[model samples]
Target chain A: MINEKDTRLSKAFITVSFIALFLGATAGLLQTLVRGGVIELPAGIGYYQLLTAHGVLLALIFTTYFIMGFLYAGISKTLGTLYEVPLKTGWLGFWMMTFGTGLATVFILLNKATVLYTFYAPLQASPWFYIALVHVIVGSWMCAFSMWRQYYIWKQITKKKLSPLFSFMAVMTMAMWFIATLGVAAAVIFQFIPWSFGWVEKIDILISRTLFWYFGHPLVYFWLLPAYMCWYVVIPKIIGGKIFSDALARLSFVLFLLFSIPVGFHHQLLEPGISHSWKFFQVVLTFMVIIPSLMTAFSMFAVFETTGRRKGAKGLLGWLKVLPWSDVRFFAPMVGMLIFIPAGAGGIINASHQLNQVVHNTLWVTGHFHLTVASSVTLTFFGISYWLIPYLSGRTLTKKMHKLGIIQTVMWAVGMFLMSGAMHLVGLFGAPRRTAYTTYSDHPQAAEWIPYQAVMAVGGTILFLAILLVLYIAYYLAFRAPKGETEFPIGEVEAAAVQTPIILENWKLWVGISAMLILIAYTLPFWHMIEHAPPGSQGYKFW
Target chain B: MPQLETNKPKKLKKAEKEQDLKGTLLSVMLLGLFIILSWGAVYALYLSR
Candidate 1:
């Protein structure tokens, strides 16, 4: 059924990944230009609708594509077998998702459902919009299944234990993905479809957001883990060092799994409908999250230390000098590390139960997420593409492209630093997020923030250009390649041999997941408390 | 497989990190102290203010 003439599954995934980044950049730039009033399209012509398209296309879809592409590319190197699942099935999935994205984009453009990314309950979009969303999530499920089937085949061939660190993390993340998307899927099918079509009287806002955040919170790590996976695996290889502590990375994944879901209650902390004690409990547990986060930081920095020693660099800060600066893969992760600082600071600030009052739903919260989610994670994905695409395609990414990638990476990092930081300041000064427009009446001088908006627009423009370059390079390597089999090291740093996870399949872990669900369900309650702040960003919408 | 490497027993006892994040070690101790102090400050200033 197969020939050497058949197209590489990696090629299809890379193509999708290319398009995803391109669309993501295009949508991102469009939103930024709109925000700055630099390029005005007619106001109230379904602007919220455009925002929804941008959110789903760039944030969720792009991330999904890149991670799936990266996974498909590494099949043999990761599995230690030449075995592969049917690339045709994956191609089938590719078209299904691609077409779904097109349908959803059209609906968004028509302003059929401008529910914003959160798409809070009671505020409904059209039935088409809900259906389009179902198609997209379902398409992602198909992609996940395709990867799992490949893993199954690889295991069948190897029969070795499934303990390769990167592979384990990939499957763990997929495992997380299948579980995490349930909340969003549940909301779409049960609440959104019926509610949007006028089938249900009205769905509850608070409870829906709770379930949404159940998916949403873990979804951050879902966006994030692949990037971290690249960090753990790729960075060490690029720098010529083994992983500093492989077990710590594993522990971090497990801890992330445990914490990311239960901590959604922290998001509901200020909501009055939730019990005081439960909110307090989540706040405490929320702080526990930084353990794995910091553990990762330490683990990787230790790798850098090891790499630096290999490079003959000296002193506590010596690694700074010898790290492959021009190699976009190496420096992008380094820059991503720097971006994490204030982002982490913002996260800790927001996760604080009492402190959240000052910044909740404000520009500050948006600022924090953009830094962590958009900058740190997205940059790392781009960084991975920079390293992997050429290797997978058996083409050499030239010095100039890598050089240009460094410039683009810096642009993104610096741009985010300026943009997210400025947004935080604006948020503290009472600027609300998610509004299509802002009006100043009582405080005429509220116009001072215009400069910051302008600065953000400039930053976003630079990053947009950077994203375009990344896509172009990715396109060339995947499609235009005059190629042979390229041997890519899927970073053989895990000295520990592969062990198939008996623990992964355990009934106890399943119970822990259920208990996690139960714990989150018990904690999610902020919908009814409209006395202090309006349910749907009420306090900040101006007169 | 993990047991193969971890045979060189952990010098730091589990008791240190075993509790709900309390007591001893450079990173953990400092991080814990930072957490407790920050929580105390937030409750006092922002919540009670």
Candidate 2:
């Protein structure tokens, strides 16, 4: 169990993450309404401003802070105490991220930075915006370093025994994130910061975009791996099952670390200047990353089947029926997996080079990501919050709250289905994304999108209600619920007869292989970009 | 007594293990089928366009 001080620190991170979710989700609701023609834009907040706030708060602030908090909890639990961690440095990281978030929030609110979440330059924000983001990333690095330090000390103490799976995974998550963020860190510090401050006359769009996506694509994995950690470690325990194969689980995470970063060019399939061969190579790598996910899907399903059958379930699909649907802990993440099926399918289309052209800038892309980050990732986070908040607060999750959680998850799914579903359909009809309103007075095609926009609005409304319910539930659990200790569900593997190989735990070899893969994927393309220098663009602020 | 007790439970455990393995293979097949069909449908949609 974590000490009180560590729990407090963890709570601080989680609390801020929820706060960001609330604010960012509010902005999303407004955008949905605006797009749906249900409401006009509120004064002083432009569409891009809202978009920037929504994306940054949810993607950057909410996910990062939540991951940090969850990892702290996982580390403390698995390592036997929080004292092994450098608590002072952990607190420092927390404050840095918090302060940086505050700084960026100010600029965003002031409309000083309306560059969308991508923050793609030559559309520059205030230099402080870039600087603020750097602070956030560096703070995250501090947290990652703290995990590394803790693991190092743990190994020193327990020389022969491998670290627990949860601790191993927590460290891996931060390590992968640390490596991935270096690309963006370099881009920000070297290029965007200087350009924003007027130290540079022009900035290279292609290089900046390339660098951003280099970080950007893997950033999804950063959000995902923690969720995967929860699914692998926590969900099986909740459902009364063991992990199918610990070796397979570790291998899957290792594969993710290797293949996740090198495939960013797939995001730029439509962009000019990058060689077609390089894009094709990256696309292949993107497909390779799917292997680990498929492994996860298989492992999870097998676990569920084993558990259900042991409980006396018969027939092929009988196992599904026996799994705990009433238990919100299992249900929420399970539903998340269900959504991920379609989300993963959509991802394949997005990665397919020729097919990608059809949906490149369309609302189809928006729909696809909504299913991914918005549904699969966010729902899992919500599921995690159900147990985690109460665990940190020293409170028991009530049955009533669990019921409410299930309802919230269902509402979110329904809303996403209606909204994202409509978005996908409309995208097929050629509706563009990133626009406040698609129904142009002059364009005949715009009229066709209005109905879908309305569906999106309705879906957004339902989702907003669901968000409100979640916030209320979280608040009630943290502050009002009766105090009690909660268990951190860490499942065992059923096939205990088969021990995970000692070689699988060799982080040094895996990291080396990951680096080699990244080098192979990136070196030539990066070299080409540098050698064939194009004239950089001057900063432009359309918003 | 020890030999008889251990042997009976061992037999039961083997049977249970077989059942679990069968269920796993069945689940995998279904999941694979779903994945292939979904991918095929999406690709076919794109090709049709």
Candidate 3:
């Protein structure tokens, strides 16, 4: 009965997202022994392969595809357009992505692309990984185009200023994504793969890692933005209040697009050859990134607080009881907020200059992102699924299944924290990230943490089961609902609210300004390749 | 006090919306630039030292 094209696009993205998460979670389970010292690698399985797979699974594929879908929904609602490009092209993009994903995975299994997910240079991978990756980039680019075209088409039709909520975030993430991928794709197509295939003479390692993660860190946000978008717009609208401020939401999205990509240098804090000014500038930016995230926390809480007060909850912490925890829509945001605490707090410290030395490349890095991502991004996706499934299929989730899903989410959140806390403690003591096992016979430092890593593995198992429960609930909602007429209105405000129109800025100036930032940030390091020749170092060319 | 009475709170004003947009864009972009420069600075400093 649901004829809306955009809603269907959102659902399609959700389904694909679930698929991607499954692969990611499955990887986590396989590598629960990742930190185990005694477990040796198979002759074919390399350490970098595992690292790349985990990074790509959690960071790139799941997040981008998920956000792409969320953008579809946000555009339709904000602009009130029922455009069909997203629908027709969305599935085409999906098949391409899936094909690309399969090829990438096969490359991993075949022991082909082991440069780590970002595919840093000197380390090499099979050509197919690069080939399939191009497929993915192209498909994603098409999807980005789909989003861009829809918004432009809507602008022509509505002429009303669109709220920033989902549309702004999606557009910015996609743009950054396009920017970040260029560096990696250039490395892959021109340098690494070609070198491996004997076409290229050599490849630049530093330049590749630099650009890959520029997109890499924010890539997680691309996934997270959709979830955040849903959280910002939907949670408020559903929880019996208007979004505290849609403009703030839009600003955050645009801010994320502009600021998030440049901050990738934070990942290279421990690396050599980058300048002090660059790191100093990035550390400052790292702190600044927290502001938007913190703003989101406050605005979301404001919306939740508004809902809580309406329920007549009084006093500090009184609103805790007021939330309809059983309602999937309500269940996720509240619980999801609870999980964001450790992750967000930990991220702030991890981003700091002094603290980077303390926990760099340690178990805490693993713990921090696991919570930030699994909690914020995953739960948001789950909440959207709850909203999307019943709306699209016209069937309500059984109360029992719904309740179970909530229980499972809580378990995953709480369990991940406990598991990760132990890892953080060990990480502070120098347990490195992305290693085969801490218990190498040669290293004495790792012995103390073997038991701790084992415990963390136990946590992964628990989370795996919990994630399965979530997937099942989603599946049931999508496929198992009883036949009936069910309609949950999207874009409905409890009461009428005034709609605002967009004010066009000097587009050329803004674009030029953004371009200037990129050129200024990147030019020196790029120029350094030739200008400040490190004596006795050989010049490597990608092309 | 000419307040429009409704169950929902008053809608966000256009100017207010613009302010938040500007602030958010300013804050987020500045932060991103900061983070990107972090590694490059550290590397450069480590060398200088």
Q: What does each candidate score in C-alpha RMSD? A: 6.3, 2.0, 6.4
Kindly indicate the candidate among 1 and 2 with the higher TM-score.
2
Q: Which tens-of-lDDT digit does each residue in A397-451 have in candidate 3?
A: 6778678778887887766766777777777667887777645675677678888
Best-matching candidate per lDDT: 2
Instruction: List DockQ for all candidates.
Output: 0.09, 0.46, 0.06
Better by lDDT, candidate 3 or 2: 2
Q: List per-prediction Cα lDDT, in the order shown.
A: 0.68, 0.88, 0.67
DockQ of 3: 0.06
- Per-residue lDDT tens digits of candidate 1, residues A475-540? 766666556444354555535324334565342585477466545545334433333334332111
Query: Where does model 3 sit among the CAPRI classes?
Result: incorrect
Give the residue spans of candidate 1 off by over 4 A: A1-7, A37-39, A43-45, A80-89, A479-487, A494-543, B1-49
Q: Which digits, one per residue and each the tens of the lDDT, describe model 2 over residues B1-49?
A: 7776687977776776766766667766776777778667667877888
List candidate 3 stretches off by more than 4 Å. A1-12, A34-51, A74-86, A442-444, A485-512, A533-543, B1-49
Q: Model 3: number of clashes?
A: 30
Chain A TM-scores of each predicted structure, in the order given, are 0.88, 0.98, 0.89
Per-model TM values vs. the true structure? 0.84, 0.96, 0.84
Clashes of 2: 0
RMSD of 2: 2.0
Docking class of 1: incorrect
